[model samples]
Target chain A: MIRRGGRRGGVVAAGLLTGALLGLGFPAPARADPEADRIGFRSYFQQRFPDVPAEAWIDGMYAIDEGARQQWQEIEDFPPYEFTVEEGQALFQDPFGDGRSYGDCFPDAGRGIRQRYPRFDSETGEVETLEVAINGCRARHGEPALSYDSKEMLALTAWIAYASRGRPMAVEVPDDARALAAYEEGKRFYYTKRGRLDMACVDCHGRYAGAFIRGDHLSASLGHPTHFPVYRLKLGGMVSLHKRFHGCIRDVGAEPFDEQSREFRRLEYFLTYMSNGLEANGPAVRK
Target chain B: MRDVVTSALVLAACLALPVARAADDSRTPAVEGVLAAVESLRAQAVTAGHEWLGTRSLLDEARAAAASGDAARALELAEQARRDCELALEQARREEEAWQGRVLR
Candidate 1:
């Protein structure tokens, strides 16, 4: 009887082991450390392109495109995004309906804070992007929030990015489980293949970085977040990062979620956090 | 003898023509069924917020082949579209449960 009871216990233990193995193959990862992920992410890019200077990554596609580099240099002489920056400066200082300005809502009067954006907001238990934070500030002042991809918001972020230029990105992923979960979701979104093309974000920016495809060089993902609200000569206008996300997913023939959705917000949080040390070099011109 | 041969030859040609045409026309209902399945699968994918990828383009090509009277080609394209939509639906369902395994930790 003791032997039979022992045999039954062994079977139960074996069943539990099998279930644990199956769980590892499916749901939430057991190990989730932001610092480890960041280190691994940077190391992967550095190992792939050992010759490219770390700082040069800020130039994005131009880090590999010589011709574009020259054109980008020329464009910088009189940057096309200059006018939008000026417009944003005006908007930043202008008061809302209650005569309270955007400066009143942020640390240091919203002077130089672009690099710390797409933060994991513990209070909300979600990732909050710069756009959302900006809108939140307006909402607190009894003003209607601007559109996620609006011209005004683009200009506003451009102004903020310009103000924060040269400051290193310092996004933080807290010790909280929700913050780690948000980052993990973004990482999954980055690597997961979707659409008929069966492509992930890593397929281009991670795997094919510096390779030219159809008259364009694939930029490394390492410093992709550094330059947003970029003036694209191809589009003849400034394009926001969330807009770029939508365009890329569509390029693979996938249906994209709306900009500022939870998926995208978490994606932004992960990417911005990954670019922790890169300088904020936005309102820049791009091909 | 010459008249008999010519008349027999003409009779043979008439009988063969309908048989070949019937063979082609026989594929029409099967193609139509697959096309309907593509739409139904696409609806499922959309409800799940999954992208149907090139399914729509494949469906369009299938209709174009049908319009051009190529029953075999139409059937082939429609079947491909149906398969792609089904795959998309499967991918959507699997990702909901499996995306975590691929996460960088």
Candidate 2:
């Protein structure tokens, strides 16, 4: 089940698909429009939940909960947490009607399958996350496409997410013609000012990263996405990569993104490219 | 004499528990101030050896409830969120330091 899939063969499929999409679609849209300046950071903290526990706010009785630092450390098992790896491993082995398993689709060569994701696939000129690739795997095997947010995918993705853990994110906006094009689009998005503050992401995370806003200090976006499926304290639950992007855009005073919007995926690609070389901190603990 | 000691202990606990007085006095200003301060620290994203973001954020919400005149909520949230934030902050700080060290290298 844990078999081989080469890298060279997918280029043909990608090229054909990219060409077809561009053939009929409208031209690329304008960059993000500016939003008004609203000065409040509560959405990051407020709307996520209500009513905290008693130990969280007692006067001078903080030792009641804040005392143990090691108590909450997540234990990393060899296989990682979640249940879908078993299914994915199974699918990897089962052969399709053409006697082609998912592994057979790839050219016979090599792959750093888990380490490279949110990758810049030059053949199609598209930025692909692991979730996209998994569906690609499904389509290659002639299986029905899985939803991007499905639990099966989330679990399999989580395992793959686990696979990428220690690897430095190698994604790059190539200096060559194709990569340069995508990079330009992304750069325009990053610096071109958007939403309420008329503030671009560069303004705060870039210029004012360490500055204090109200009470909490702002973190620099550098090395930000080292973890995935991070345990968010705000929602009292776990949140995924794009969800964070959605929150950040909303916080900027623009309308939140539809979770699966191409705009978001492009933004995610650009952002991920920006933080390249940083290891994934997915399945992390965020305040 | 026994009655006097019991009364003294009860008085100390009363001062300690806002809800002990009115069962609704959960917004301890002192605690809220620190919680807010911790949140500020979290945004700095230089979490120390602790993981307190959740605790701090949760505490703020609870404090709001208490301040809105719900002593019961204030007391409950104060205790729980405080514990979570404190520990979380410490963990975050430690990890942040380690992460920065790696980055700086």
Candidate 3:
């Protein structure tokens, strides 16, 4: 269950989105004020759920502990993190389907504007959104493929999300029957109960979106993904979508999906599509 | 889908109901756990008290969860019951040794 705090506080935020999109109407968050940076968002969340582990809420968007390396703390390295960022930058720089980079496609790879995902693609005849397009770029360009659920891909994806920071998520399914079908399919996935607890993703996040779960406040999933690649407290660094999905399942004692399993991808498609109008703030942190 | 949230919670409660029953029956899982932990400590006898305390807290939390209307939440809390007791047993052993050594000194 992703919460909606810490600039779309992962599951906490995800929960809110889940509830709202499912037609479970809870109050959407008030519009973010000008000072609505990750820190402010996090502070507001902490006030609401003080019991959540303090470490769980630390923002991971900034460069990891350069000072630690400056000293001698023997910090764990994230060369892969840098590599993933490079990959994302490349995609942003050159998603050239017709010899045109994304810079040429939609200026700035559509930076600071995450409000355009889950859109219907008339040409593709599918609801290909941000991730789908990125993967398509990989396929058409003969780039090494990245799984939708892979951390390698997600880190890059998070950077794309980062590029779109401050932009509202503006996903809109076409009113066509097929698009409606996809939205309904996503809705079905969200409401279905799975896992050992017989819990669905909605159990904690939806029902208790603003309530306490152990030491943490349950975040609504409404605006999830606003800040991702968020530093997971227990994980000790930024994590990807699939990792968060696995975490939710584990907490419910459910069987987690294979790294790129269809069930997981379908769920991702559904969830991300639903969060159509929130911003993307990646490489953040949460409890 | 207002039902999505509550319905899911209801289902979770159902999944966890049996565990609450298990938690209540001391002769069942909880006691068995405490016995296993105490038995382990009797040999080392080093951290018995701590283990006992840990188990106590775990059991308390488990009992609290089991007592909740949401059975799934209870069972989820229950699973930790055994471990918490085990930790307390360890802590007890450490405390006992400290006390004894001080008296001797």
Q: List the global CA lDDT of all models.
A: 0.83, 0.51, 0.51
The lowest-lDDT stretch of 10 consecutive residues in candidate 2 chain A is: A33-42
Q: What would the TM-score be for candidate 2 when compared with the true structure?
A: 0.47
Off by over 4 Å in 1: A1-29, B1-49, B53-82, B93-105
- lDDT per residue (tens digit) for residues A1-287 in model 2: 22223343466668777887788575655332111100112122122223422112111111123332233343333223334444544555667676876566432211234445566777777776666776787787678887765656655555555545566666655545655555445444455444334455656654564456665445544445455655455565456677777787667644455554555556566655545545554544555
Per-residue alpha-carbon lDDT of model 2 for B31-98, expressed as tens digits?
45655664564443322212222444566676677567666566567667555554444544443333
What DockQ does each prediction reach against the true complex? 0.26, 0.01, 0.01
Please count the clashing residue pairs in each candidate, in the order shown: 0, 70, 60
Candidate 3 residue A163 C-alpha distance from true site, Å: 1.5
Give model 2's docking category: incorrect
Off by over 4 Å in 2: A1-114, A212-215, B1-105
Worst 10 residues of 2 chain B by lDDT: B96-105
Which candidate wins on TM-score? 1
Off by over 4 Å in 3: A1-87, A94-107, A110-113, A122-126, A149-152, A258-262, B1-105
Best candidate, DockQ-wise? 1
Per-residue lDDT of model 3, residues A1-287, tens digit only: 23334555666678877977667766664332212222343444355456653233222212123342333222224423445566667756654445655454355665764456556676755666556666676666566666765655666666676677666555665656666565544444455554335455655654455565665456654456455555555655567665777777766644455433444545555666545444565545454
Interface RMSD of each: 2.8, 16.6, 20.7
Per-residue lDDT over A132-236 for candidate 1, one digit per residue giving the tens place of the 0 to 100 score: 999998999998989987889999999999999999999988889999999888887887777767677888888888898889899988888988989988899
